[model samples]
Target: MTLVEAQIDRIVGPTHHFGGLGVGNIASQQHQGQTSNPRAAALQGLDKMRTVASLGVPQVILPPQIRPPIDLLHDLGFTGSLTEILPQVANDAPELLSAVMSSSAMWTANAATVTASVDSAHGTPTMTVANLSSSLHRAIEPQQTLCDLQRLFASFATIIAPLPGGAAMRDEGAANHMRLGSDLESPGIHIFVYGDQAPLPHRFWPRQTLAACQAVARQHGLPPENTFFLKQHPETIDAGAFHNDVVAASHHNLFLHHASAYYRADDTLAQIQRRFDDLHADGLRRIEIPESELSRTDAISTYLFNSQIVSSSTDQRPTLLCPMQVAENSCAASIVQRWIDEGLFADAKFLELRQSMSGGGGPACLRLRVPMKTRELSDLKTSCQWSASLDRALRQVIQEDYPESLDRDDLTNWQIAEKCLAAARRIQDLLAPTR
Candidate 1:
């Protein structure tokens, strides 16, 4: 009857290019149209998976989906064989081609919001894929993401479809959702953070609406008292921390966030405590890092809050799996050091994930966290499971096949398409031994 938690990280695909399409992600726009090293990128992701697994946590791999969505091209009225249409679209509409080629879905943090089996009505975990319909580039991801998740988790979880595409229904997924529990085995609290939608002082977009979060909670059949909703500080969004995770992170009973992470910060914590009190779950651990300690800009830029916190096997205290960039940034480095010195966590584990970082996603942005029982965990095969063999195989494919660098114009190259498909097929072969 033991329960466990799984953190699923998606491998960045061969089509990892900067379309600069993500409206709220500053790095995507900052590095737009720049040639990306896909080979190194995928390997870097593998390295991260290997590193996190070494840290005494269960890690799972979510495969990357085929990009330049060929089916979508056909739907767009481009009639031709696969080979012919790629060039036609590339020549006529490279911008559209760029959108199709985007691999931003690799950041599965936006993939969906998950409610664990312990929290759901049917005693099955429920996943809701984000529509991501807010932008032309991301709108196409949900359908494929749903298909893949169904194939991967069919035995043990209920999957919910994305909200209907509209300004009102825009759902950005787990980035807006944070789960808190005393341990992975217990019933946990679901905290949904949202931003203001109306045209504010600036044109900053609020990806998840309060309505969307509420609908998701009900879909999962979470009790009203167990679900809490809070408004994200608009000023943080304007400063480029678009999603709640940008400024806050929660695991087990610990809720670590910036002082500016939410409006009426102390009151939000009180409300969270009240909600947790209703559940009769373990008490909450609230860690608020004052802005005076670290500026919101530094927090967002260094992705300090986006760092993953796992229970250390050595001391059983929370340990941060932070991006290596945090150590490189003087402001962030000092704070992280001080945190460790003060025993906030037993220690910090820094990982190199620059490719994901280049696009404004960090360690926390690469995965979805779900708590489930041991039997339900067996529902997935070794392909999705993390291991040294799978790790080496994926890295080999990336080194031998994935392109070293790619830019916007390369989307039209049929040869690259064939190679990309081949690389994907190799990844497919690794997952071939499912069971």
Candidate 2:
């Protein structure tokens, strides 16, 4: 099958702030209450998309989820009008106000779990927006996420209604999912890593349950043989690597992860290899970076694996799109240099996404890659795809609409909240096709 994989990244919203919302995300907590630059954050994200597009990759923007999320306020019984509700919630439950207003939706990697036609038993490309129902901050996302994607891929793809919201079916979206295909458009193994659900007094929060993974796979109709579910190492979670993506990442047929990423590194590799071999011998290209070479703390701190490996249409090796912090760290820089010398990657493109990095996200965290074939790609709402002009237009939106900065005190301001809502509507207007 001739297929194309497009990367969809969420544009940062004007209300972006250092709410430090996500549980167990070290950077989010460490950078809590810090002043945030909304303009720089969104522009940097756009710059990343532009870089990927220049490399011949099709790109799309998943516009930021509406901020000052009033949905939660209504649910919390602060009902009157948005103007009245804002002050009431701010006084009665300030923390809740902050949680709902978070810009965490910019990390669209956790937006959904996608299954390509090549990998699905039903033989149709599918998207199932995660019911990020565990943490209150993220729980409000699935509904709006579904609405935007439904509009974006309305004609071509099938989208599964989100799994019901609750702790039992806590789904962390694509961040906890990995696909390994020699060609992304072809069939490959689907690895779903969920945390230990039985019982544990672990220090950090454990997201992505096994039941949720199984439910998503079933919903997408993925063939049982090609799908693999593994228990995440509780130790890694305790160490502040909240999501699997923090320690592991894959591209094409290459799966590169830290040795401590899984519960039993060697055994997990063997099982994965066996599954791949069952399909075809030597189908897997694996690399496990040992702790001695790069420690787990450093891996999480620097986000080495969160880099996106973009393959060239030419014979050149894939370039690793990384956060500049990786190269700035002395030891990680040497290790990356060693990898380049060893022919592991073409080269590293370090991005100054300090805004995103401050919130525990990198290149990989910002996108959800969906592999589609010629027909499926064509069936997509073409207007939603990224273009040079769209980039300029979006920047114009920021200039005219988005806030320059967002701080803790701004959450309670009804006028600021109204402005945020107006700015979001303007973005929606920009996204709409010229009629």
TM-score for each prediction?
0.95, 0.95
Candidate 1 steric clashes: 1
lDDT of 1 at 228: 85
Model 2: per-residue Cα lDDT over 343-401, one tens digit each = 87887889989999999898899999888886787766656677888889988888877
Tell me the tens digit of each residue's lDDT in model 1 across 131-226. 886788778888988987787787789988898747787888999998887655677888998786443416478777888888898889997777
Q: Where does candidate 2 have its weakest 10-residue lDDT segment?
A: 196-205
- RMSD per model, one decimal: 1.9, 1.9
TM-score, cand. 1: 0.95
Check candidate 2 and list the clashing pairs: none
